[model samples]
Target: MATPIPPPAVTVEEILAELDALDDPKMRAVNERHGNDIGVNLSQLRAIAKRLKTQLEFAQQLWATGDSQARLVAILISSPKKYTAEQLDTMLRETRVPKVHDWFINYILKKNPESESRRIPWMDDVDEFVASAGWALTSHAVAQRVENLKIAELLDAIEAEMKLAPDRLQWFMNECLASIGIHYPKYRARAIEIGERLEVLKDYPTPPNCTSPYAPIWIHEMVTRNEGASEVT
Candidate 1:
């Protein structure tokens, strides 16, 4: 009585084809029109490329984060290439039972001849597109969710460029911070404190009609200092 489930749509060959596009020099056309050739421009281009890679990788990463079936689907859908029917069935079954081997082999075998789905980076990889998108998305998403109209698209763009996984980025920053030869504990402690502060601030509801505490106060501290005020508002 129930409708036969539509086939799990993507095919393996399609995945393999999609994986081939990586590092395609043609992708450079996206930025070649910018016409800048300075060191700053080179750095900017490098950052742009890194974001594209991260967004692509994170599309796969999202799959790894969901429920097992969902995760497996994510992996198949976003991975650089497809798995063999045996491999895919194995992964699907493993989503529920890690060691089970029994499967619908004939159907799988028949389907395996052309299992690849069309590679759809523009469609499948939202993260890559997302990384390149301007800050309007952030202001819209943030304001809609939290209702802060103080949105600055330019500031959001800067923040997005600056964002990174702290632990990972800190691992790199640690080397430079270490070169100064300051006591490592103080360095680490300061890092940890900043991390803690950021988490608290981000998670705390941005209070209605309240500006960010970390934002610079409007009243000039120079005026307050002349008035001999401490902790000037």
Candidate 2:
């Protein structure tokens, strides 16, 4: 039989050094403004992750280092299915950087089997970040139209609390509203009305040619885009 080649050496220190080597001051400044203290070009970080391949143990070690850039790499390498729900929850709690927190929710938690189960409890969590994750999950669910989501109850909660929600939590809540307005035709009018009334993120700076994040405008823009694409086909 042919001999199998050994896996390449990998360590947290080496990965940290690699991340440091890729860091950019301009990127770091932009990230810091958005609550991420460390910034390595995400494309470069993704390349490092692709080279390492998926290793849950190595990913965990990187996560433990608590460097935002390292955690981004960790998120890229980690398997959502390998983690217990409790461990995922703990990781979410420990994620203090905005970029890292967003990536964990987007790349890991969204793929986890326990995601739907965690949604309500997390939505109610006292911690803003955790609650934001819950809302993020909820927004995903809304877009996917997952069963038994209590749509009326969601709109009710948004109508009642979204105006006063902390910034991070409020962003996700706004997302959920936009998702509902964009996806569910029956509730579309109500969603738009709610969004206009609250005006959450209405004045949020949008780059040239980018749709606004103001829920009402976002709902309209996305709905129009989807319709146009449908017509093209």
Indicate which candidate wins on lDDT: 2
Give Cα-based local distance difference scores for all models.
0.30, 0.91
lDDT of 1: 0.30
Local accuracy of candidate 1 as per-residue lDDT tens digits, 1-233: 99754333333344323333333344434433442111223333334323333232443443344332223223332333333544543333333221111111112222343222211111122232212211212222332343442323322322333235232222222222221112222233343334333332334355676533221221122223435754553
Looking at model 1, which ten-residue stretch has the lowest summed lDDT? Answer: 97-106
Minimum summed lDDT over a 10-residue window in model 2 is located at: 2-11
For model 2 the local lDDT of residue 48 reads 90
Per residue, candidate 2 scores C-alpha lDDT tens digits across 147-214 of 88888889999999999999999999999999999999989999999999998898999999999989
Clashing pairs in model 2? none
lDDT value for model 2: 0.91
**What is the Cα-based lDDT of residue 183 in candidate 1?**
20
List residue ranges in candidate 1 displaced over 4 A.
1-16, 21-138, 141-233
